[model samples]
Target: MTDPLQDPRFLQDPYPAYARLRDAAPVQRVRTGSDGLHSYLVTGYAEARAAFTDPRLSKDTARFFAGRPSGRELHPAVSQTMLASDPPRHTRLRRLVTKAFTRGSVERLRPYIQEVTDGLLDGWAPGGEADLVEDLAAPLPVTVICQLLGVPEADRAAVRGWSDDLFASGEPARTDAASHALAGYLAWLVAAKRSTPDGSLLHDLVRARDGEDRLTEDELLSLAVLLLVAGHETTTHFIGNAALALLQDPGSLARLLDEPEAFAGALDELLRFDSPVGIATFRYSTEALTLGGTPIPAGVPVLISPGAANRDPVRFAGPDGLDLGRDAGAHLAFGHGIHRCLGAPLARAEGEIALRTLFTRFPRLRLAAPEQEPVRRRTRLMRGLRSLPVTW
Candidate 1:
């Protein structure tokens, strides 16, 4: 059967489909595209967790397709980054970048995060409608990431345009164009950073590239693009999805508003309820492996759905319901194993500050168009509303 996942409705509310898939089997093969591309989908929590840490499931796409002839080649900017690499290369790149994304480093930005949140919300006058995605969710993370990377304010719009195009679905040509544009911009940015270091994370990366044999010129450029794009994209969706969830449930919203100090704990449950990243990035089998009693052949692609696994009936009681007090710290929203999201700490900090400040500033915040259905982004990789209209 053709994949039901390609349906836009599935993207908007995939929990039902995920429940069906999880109940049917722990792992099932499905055709992902009309191009005859197929992959194994791991839906159960135990199976999904194992798939994430399995050494046989490789992230090195190039190695996975070594002798095969494919119509498209992933841009060096994406292919060479730590996200798409294997160890010792992944080890080297991740080690250098981890220095800037530590819990302490991200925690230090809490004050700045609140300041940015306040500044954004201050622009939206009471009783006037504003798109939460545009005014708050989208710009907040981009501004923080740009500042952290030392990207100039004048250049942020262009950066955002390129990043959006890169993640946009069903636009191969646009995706390629954005990849090249982003790569070219990063190349220039790195060169400019080298001439005049600014103490930003990008500056430190440039130093690593030039001072030691640690990172190559290509790796440096790729890592910068990865940091800029991945740093904000997931967090942007996290804020939007979390807000939408609360808005849909007035009881939850009222409760959250009353307990302002509980935002941190509440954020984890929000992430688990509707994870920003629906599925983990592609992984291929290095050798034939059996998962949940099903044998997957080597060279076949495998996708682990955290969206599905988080709601597994066996894992959490009342998995579908939003429980702010639930211990959801183990959710695979940041993924697992060596390739886990490097910017997770930063994303969490941003989510907590953004949600708390937003609701606190506009306690009467409510959906501007309650009768209208939310328009979700069509991308297969992410699960988020394209826009969230709100007013106080």
Candidate 2:
């Protein structure tokens, strides 16, 4: 009975555990702390993919909690978003902003992204180390996304704070409070954009419509908040985790440095080797479904562990090793089926460019702190170092 939540082994390296689970049983009923809700954790590659695309699986927490007086309430704004909805509305909402993340759209922002990365690197004094998470990884996405959203540069810090408070916390109560604050902040931004829309993603979304269909006030705020949080936090981790991986494997770093173009392949490998969003956004069961030979009764909560599946030996040849040139496209790090991450292309571009800039500029970069002392978060949803102290 491995307690997945508090397992120290899982906290460090979960590959062995995932292999065991994948081999022993496609589905395992993990015991929960008495207080936590009972749920199914999908680990097998095939089963996980099936669970991801299953129509019987629901993302709307409201339907799962219907008539249940569990003192827990899903945030209305969050629950109403496309991420939490099924077809029709989901297709409509997703189509509204899909054009904003096309190849051309993301590529156009590369120069601006490079400038942001360089500005942050320039601020780091020679031989004077700082937390890479703070000085670079954390701020780069903030600047890039803020500019893309047409958010006033002055509001960047405030928006970042709101996003962090909203998503970084593990506790449900705290997350709810942060969600409230985030919703309010987004509402304010919508009003501000009303009077002064500019050439940015947010403004484009404001003007976006399908014939006569347009986003409602709540939909607008919800989508903006989703982009703000999703745009930065995931990219922050991608940059930090990929950099940390390269630092740990100097050979990989050197390879990437020599052939910057190798980033497309290497980035995929890094993502497959160690993903940031360990689990997909929470999925709830709509009907009694058999997953991995286990009966998942209707209304049970489900989480597909992409981190676990990415390292599953059944999926990767050398699952535990970091192969910079591996064909890592099959990994579910960006998820599978219809709900795959919409910002994935942008994230991949940002990661490739950011990693290239990092290694190329600071050729001698190494961890300032001892390897064992590196900071890591205890969060179950997103796996990342809290702070990565490094010096050139």
Best candidate per lDDT, number? 1
lDDT of 2 by residue, 273-356 (tens): 889987678788878989888888887788888988888777788778899878888888888888898888878878887888
For residues 51-117, what per-residue lDDT tens digits would candidate 1 score against the true structure? 9889898889778777887665457887557788888888888887776567897888889998999
TM-score of every prediction relative to native: 0.97, 0.94
Candidate 2, position 48, lDDT? 88
TM-score of 2: 0.94
Runs in model 2 deviating more than 4 A are 32-36, 168-170
- Model 1 weakest lDDT span, ten residues long: 206-215
Clashing residue pairs found in predicted model 1: none
Q: What ranges in model 1 sit over 4 Å off?
A: 209-212
Give Cα distance to truth, residue 241, candidate 2, Å.
1.0
For model 2, which pairs clash?
A: none
